[model samples]
Target: MTAVEYEENESKLMRKAKENPFVPAGILGCFAIVAYRLMKMKNRGDTKMSVHLIHMRVAAQGFVVGAMTLGVVYSMYKEYVLQPAAAQKALEQKTALEK
Candidate 1:
C-alpha cells in the first residue's frame, strides 16, 4: 500500500473537529478570554506591571493545559468505554442472527 501523507492527516483532524464540535469551541473560548484580558490591561511598566504580566502568562498556560487535559480524557473515554460497548452490541446482534 502507498504511504499516506500530511494532507490525509489534516483531513482526519478536520473530520474529528466535525465529529466533536465542542473541542474547537472550547479552545476558541480560552483564546478569547486571554485576548480580552491582555487588551484590557493598563499601560504600565513598573514592577507591578511585570508581576501582572507574569500572572497573565501563567493563567494563559494553565488554560491551555486544562483544555488539552479535557480533550485527552474525553478521547480516552470514547475509545475505552463507548467503542467497546458499541462493538459488543454489534457482536451480540451478529451472534443472535447466526443462531
Candidate 2:
C-alpha cells in the first residue's frame, strides 16, 4: 500500500488497540510466555523450532479468538445496555419538558 494509506490504517489500528487494550496485552503476554519457555530450553534444534512454531500459531489463533470475543461482548453491551439507558434518559427528559 501507499505510505499515506499505510499510515491511516496504522492509526486506525492504534485507535482500536487503545479502545480495547486487553487484546494487545493478551497477545504480548502470550508471546512473552512462549519466549520464556523457549529460553529455558537447553536443547534447541530443527525439531524444537518446529514445535515452537506450532505453539506460536496457537498463540496467534488465541489472539484472534480473544479479540473477536471481546469485540462481540463490547458490541452487545453498547447495544443493549448503553443505548437503552441513553434512550431512557432522553425519554425522561422529554417527559419532564412536557410536564
Please, what is the whole-model Cα lDDT of each candidate in the order they appear? 0.72, 0.71
lDDT of 2 by residue, 37-69 (tens): 567555555557668768766876677678678
Per-model TM values vs. the true structure? 0.69, 0.59
Candidate RMSDs in order: 4.5, 6.2
21-51 per-residue lDDT for model 1 (tens digits): 5567566767877787678576545648667
Model 2 misplaced stretches (Cα beyond 4 Å): 1-10, 18-23, 26-34, 37-47
Best by TM-score: 1
lDDT of 1: 0.72
Task: Kindly report which residue pairs in candidate 2 clash with one another.
Answer: none
Cα RMSD, model 2: 6.2
What TM value does model 1 have? 0.69
